[model samples]
Target: MLVISYDLEVFTPPCSPGALTFSAIARLQGNIAPALPYLNAVLPNAVYNPGAPALVWKDGRRHVVFHADHLAVSNLEDRNAAVEQVERLVRLVNETWQERGQIEPSYAVRQRPTPMMLYKLLPGTNCRECGQATCWNFALKLGAGQVTVADCRPLADPIYADRRAQLLASVIEDQFV
Candidate 1:
């Protein structure tokens, strides 16, 4: 396994003193730089920087960063959640390393679409079916990785097939695929 041991540190973010969410960092015993490109290839919407030898990804509402020596996860609920997330990340690294041969490593940096860019591709109905106040709000959440394209019910309409196709192809990550 690439990551067999780690030291976990969990704490509330200094920038948000009153916030309830926590963040955690796993100081790994092994260098995970070699597995980054493989992770970049498998994790949809992941941003990889070969120069920094780091990979950034969004797991639901959480922000995760994988460095050569450490893995950091933010926006966790509690200490247990933090620990669980770190463990999950370590497993992900080890699994990716083991399966590297089956996966094609990606070194190219991919930029995530901006909120405005995603908004243009949306149906723009402002229907609030997605529980957001507006289409722009949904777009912002989508771009931030807080919501998926499927959350927008209007996009399921036959009339919006083309726009849905464009959004999924360009902005949204198809996790099922």
Candidate 2:
């Protein structure tokens, strides 16, 4: 296993003091630099930096960073949640390491789409079908990896087919693929 042992540290974000959210770091006993490219290949929407030997990914609403010596996760609910997330990440690393031969490792880096870029492609109808206040808000969430292009219901309309296609091709992760 890539991460058979680790020391966990969980705390509130220093920048967001008193915030309800938590962040955690797992100091691994071994280096995981070699597994990053494999992780980048398997994780859609992941941002990998080969120079830094780090891989950044979004797991649901949480932000996760995998480095050579440690794993960091932020925007968690509580200590228990942080622990669970770290455990899950460790398992993922081990599994990915074991299955590395079956997967193609990728060294290409991907940039997350900007909010403005996503907003321009949105329908801009201010529809509440996505449960957000405005299309701009949805764009912001989409850029942050908190929401998917599919959440914008208006994009499903035939009239917005081209825009939808553009979003899928340019920025949105292809979950179906």
List TM-score per model, in order.
0.64, 0.64
Task: Give residue 99's lDDT in candidate 2 (0 to 100).
Answer: 99
**Cα RMSD, model 2:** 9.0
- Which pairs, if any, clash in model 1? none
lDDT of 2 by residue, 1-177 (tens): 878799999998664568688889899999999999999999987878787677888777676888899888876999999998899999999999999999999999866667888899999989699999999999888877777776787786878967775565444222211
The sequence of per-residue lDDT tens digits that candidate 1 reaches over residues 1-177 is 888799999988664577688988899999999999999999987878777667878777677888898888876999999988899889999999999989999998866678898999888879899999999999889887777776887786778867765565443222211
Candidate 2: worst-modelled 10 consecutive residues by lDDT: 168-177
Q: How close is candidate 2 to the true structure, as a TM-score?
A: 0.64
Instruction: Tell me the spans in candidate 2 whose CA falls farther than 4 Å from its real position.
Output: 111-177
Error of 2 at 171 (Å): 16
TM-score of 1: 0.64
Q: How much is 4 displaced in model 2, in angstroms?
A: 1.9
Per-model root-mean-square deviation over C-alphas: 8.7, 9.0
Model 1's C-alpha root-mean-square deviation from the true structure amounts to 8.7
